[model samples]
Target chain A: MINIKKLALLIVFIWPSVLLAETMEVTLLYVGPTDSQAWAGSQQGLDEANLQGQFLGQNYQIKSVTMKELQDLPASNMTAILVDASKKNVLSLAQDAKYSQVPIFNLTSTDDALRSACVPNLFNILPSDQMDKDAIAQWQAKNPDIAVKAQAWHEDFVKFAASQLNKRFKRNHNVNMTDDAWAGWASVKMISDTVARTESIKSTSLLEHLKNDLSFDGQKGDTATFRETGQLRQIVLLVNDKNEIVAEAPLRGVKNGLDSLGKTTCQ
Target chain B: MKFKSLLLSTLIMASTAAMAEPSHRVFISNEKSDSVSVIDMKTNAVIKTINVGERPRGIGLSPDGDKLYIAVSEENAIAVVDLKTLQLEKKLDAGDDPETFDVAPNGYIYLSNEDDAQASVIDPKSGKVIETIPVGIEPEGVAVSPDGSLVLVTSESTNMVHVIDTAKHKVVKNILVAARPRGLAFNSDGSLAYSTSEVGNEVTVIDTKSLSIIKKASIDLKNSKPMDIKVSPDGKTLYVTTGRGNSVAVLDADTLEMKANVPVGKRVWGLGMSKDGSTLYTADGVSSTVSVVDTKTNKAIKTIEVGQFPWGVAVDD
Candidate 1:
C-alpha cells in the first residue's frame, strides 16, 4: 500500500531539486572580445559567481555569445543574461529580452537613454558614468597641486586631462574622452575586484549578494558600490593630455556620497 | 542486523565518494584584501593568510616552488616568501608599480613596472634589483624567452613588445603589436611567442628566430578583450582569456584560427596550465575564484574558491 500523503510531501520537496539538478544555461552578451582586458575582467567575475554552485544545484553553463548571435539564441532556455559595457547595442537586446520578461544585467557604465527607454528588466551591475565623473571631481578637490601641475603641462601631455576635465565640467563626461590605457585598465580592475568578492552563485541569492555586498576599489581613489537604482558611487581619475594621472574624485554616494548627475546639476 | 550493516557500508561509501586528492598548497594574492590566502589543495581549505605589501597583483613560484615572489604594486617591490616556512624572507625593490612578472631559466626574475615604464631584472637570491631596463609606457605583461637568453615586456601605452637581451640588459628590438598589448607567452618549442592585445582583440604571433610578428590572428570574440595568453604543453593550441567576452578563446597554433570558446569566469586574467598539461587553471579576478578546466573536455569542471580579488595563479608540481 502506498502512503499517499507522505509520497505527495516527498514529491513536492524533491520536485524543485529535480528541476534544479537540470543545469540552467546563461548566455553572456559581451560588447567587446572575450579577450579584451576590460571585458575579461568582468567575465572573470561572472565565471567565479557560476563556480560557487549556488544558483541551480547543477552548475550554470555560461556561454559567451556574440552580439550578433543574441537574436539567434533561444531566449526561452536562458536563465539570465549578463551584458558587458562595451556592447554598444545593449539597448536593443534589453528591449528584446524585456518582452520575454528575462532579466538583463549590465555591468558596464550605465546609459541614460537605455535606462529610461528600456523596461525595468535591465539592471546595471556597475556604477553610472556620472559616478566616475564625481570621483574625478572629488579627487581634484583634494589634490589641487597635481591638478594645477597637470593643467600646466596640458598641451604637451596627451588629451586625457583636458577632455576629462571638460567632460566633468560640461556635464558630458564620457569615458571615451581619452586613450589612457591606465584609466581603462583601472576601471576593469575595479569591476574585477567586485566580482571576486562574490560569496555565492545561486541566481536569486547571487543577485542579492551582488547588490548588497559587491564593492570595488575604484580607480578614482575610493571604494565604489553598485546601488539599488543601478548607480555606482566611486572615484574617477582625471588624466592630463600628457597621459599622466592628475587627480582622483568621488562620484555617487549611497548616504553621504554625491548624488547622481541626474539628481544634481553640479556641473 | 543486515540492514544496519548495509547502512554502515553505504554511509562509509557516501563519506568517501567525493574525497579529493590531498590538498596541495595554493597561494592566492588578494588585491583588495592585500593578503595571500594559503589553501591546502588536499583539503581545499584556507590554511592561513599572509599579508604582503600594498596592492599585491602578480605572483610566481620559484623553479623549485620553495619561494613565492609577490608583486606589490604600490610599494614598487617584490616580496619573496619562503614557501616551506611560509615566512616573508625578503623584499626586492623593483621600479614603480610592478604589476606582472616571470621567472627566468637562470633563476632571475623579470618584472614589469607600469608607472616607471621599465622592466627590472631582479636576482631572487640576493633580494636586489639587478637591472632596470626601460621598455615602454605602462609595461605590464612579461615572459622569459624559452632559451632564457631574452625577456619580452609588453608596453600597453606604446603597443610594442620590447625584447630585452638578458645578458646586455638593454632593449634589443621593439616589435610593434596591436593596440594595448598586455599578456605574453612563449610556445613550448620557443619557436614563436604569442602576445595578446586588449584593444586590437587579436593575438600577434612573433617568430623568435626572425624577431618579427610573422602572423596576426584575430580572436573574434564579440567584444573580445584578450588578456593573458598561454600555449599548451603540446604547443598545438593557444589558450587566451577574453576579458570582455567572458570565455577562453582557443586557437589552433598551426592554423592560427579560432578553434573554440571555452567559457570561463568573468574577466579571466592570469592563466596557467598544470604541470602535466591535463588541466588549465584561470585566475578569475572578478569572481574571486579559480576555474579549473579539463584540457581534454575543454570545459570548466570545477571552481575553486580562493582569496579576495584573485588575479594571478601558479600551479606547483
Candidate 2:
C-alpha cells in the first residue's frame, strides 16, 4: 500500500507537464501561385516552424488557396494568410470582414496608397513606394542630383545568415531566393515567432501582440519593427547599376535609421 | 673577453624569444573556407591560417591548453592541432557531423552529433568513441560543468537542453526552453547554466542544482537573436553574441538585466573571454572578422579580419 501511494504521488507531479506539452497546430494559408518563389518560402518557413515544434510540442502546417477560395473560407480555425497578389486584390482581401481579425501579410505589393489605407491586421512586409521615395529624398537631400536605386533584398547579401538562408533555399528549390520569397519566409517567421513567444494561437491575441509589441528579426541584420501604418520599417538596400548593393538607407550616420526609413503613422 | 661575449649572447637570445612569441593566442574556425585562422591576441595579427579539414566549425582547446581541437563537420572528426607547432596533430572520430563540443575533466571529448541526434564521448588519446548518449534532434551546443560531473547539450530543432550525468553517461533531466535553443554555458561554480534560444530570442537561466529554470530574459534588442553566451570569470556579467543584432549584449548575471550592447561585426556567432575576463573575442560569421572588446569599457577596440565565415573562436591564454 505504501508503494502504491508513492506511485500515485509521482503521477500527480508528472501529469501536468505532459498535458502542457500538447501540440499546438498552427495552420498558415498561402495566397500565391503554387510555383512562385513566394509560396516556396512560405512552405519552407512552415517546415522550419514544424521542425521547431517537433521538439517543443507545436505543429505548423501551410495550405495554398486562391483569392476565390480565401473569400469563402470561415475564420473559425483562424488561419493566417500570406498575400502575393496585386494592390486591388490585396486591398479587397484586407477589406473583407471575414479576415478583418486574421493576420494577413502583403508579401509583394509596394504601393504607398495601400499603407495609407492602414488595415490593422494587414502587414506590409515589403517597403512601400513612399518609403523608397523618402529613402532617395534623404539621400538627395545630402547629395543633390544623385541617381538612386534601391531594393527590398539583394541576392549577394551575406550577413545575418542571409547567405545560409539563401543556400538552403537554393539547394531546395534550385533557384536564387528572390525578394518576394524573402517576404513570404519573413511573414511566416513573424507569425510563428509570435505564436511561440506568446504561447497563444488566437487571432485577436496575435494581432494585438503584433501591434503593441512587434520586434521581429527579419534576417536583415537588425530588428524589423512595424509602424502604425502597418509597414515594416526596413533598411532600403541602395543598389548600383550592376545590381549590387552599395550602401544602406537610412544611411549609416542617420539617427534612428530604422525608424527613419518609412512612414511612421497612417494618414 | 669570453665572459663578456657570453653575457651579450644571452641578452640577444632573450630579446629574440620575446619578439617571436606572445603570451596568448586566438583560433577561429572558418567554416566555409575549411581553415583555422590563428591570431596573436597581444598584437591582433593573423599569424597563420591552417587548412584543417572540410567545413571546420566549433573550435576548442584541451583542458591543459596543449592541443587545439577543431570540429571538422564534413570529415566527421575533430582535427587536433599542436599548440606549439601550430600543425595538425591528428584527427579523432567524433561521430557524424560534429559541431559544438566540450572537454570533461577526465579529458574525454563530449561531441554533439547533430545528424544522428546523439552525443558521443571520445577518448582523445586513443581517438575512440567510448560511449554514445541519445539526445534531442539536431544537437548543436555542448557545455560541460566546471566540476565535470555533468554536461548539457542543446537541441536546436527540439527546443530542449538535455543534461547528461558524466558518471552515469546518461541524461538525468531534460530542461525545456524557448524555440531553437542554440548555445549553452555554465557558470564558474557549476551552480547555474544559461542557454540562448536562437528563434525565440530569449535566454533562459537554469539553476543547476534543481535543474529548474530561474528566469527567461528577452534580449530586448531589435534584431537580436543570440547565438553563443559566456559568463565572466567573477560571474558578475554575462556576455551574449547577438546573431543579427551585430552586437555583444552584456547582461547582469545576478538579475539577468540588460546592461549594454557593444556593437561588433555583422552576424556575430561565437565568443570567448580572456582568462582574467578583461577582454572578449567575438567571431563575426558573415563579415569574416573578429571583434576584440575591452571588458572594462564594454567596447570593441579593434576588428581583425579572419578567414571566410569564421564560426567558432577559441582563446588560449
Model 2 lDDT per residue over A1-267, tens place: 999999999899889887887788888887878788788888767766665566457788888888778767888777588888999989988988888889889999999877999988889988998778777777777777557687778788876446656765676678888778888888887787678767788888889888887656565655577888889888887776777776778885777777777678875
Name model 1 segments beyond 4 Å from true.
A1-267, B1-24, B39-45
Per-residue lDDT tens digits of candidate 1, residues A1-267? 369988998999999998757654333344445544345344333443343223223233346677667667665544456565543566677667332454466655445554444344555544354555555456555655554221111212323223322222123222232222222333333232232233222234434544565434222322345444544444334565466666433322323544523323212
Error of 1 at A52 (Å): 44
Tell me how each candidate scores on DockQ against the true complex.
Answer: 0.01, 0.08
lDDT of 2 by residue, B206-253 (tens): 999998899988888987888999999988899999988999999999
Off by over 4 Å in 2: A1-21, A136-148, B1-57, B72-77, B92-100, B106-141, B147-183, B196-204, B209-213, B216-228, B239-251, B257-271, B274-317
TM-score of each: 0.53, 0.75
| lDDT of each residue in B73-118, candidate 1, tens digit only | 8888898887767888888877777999999878899999776567
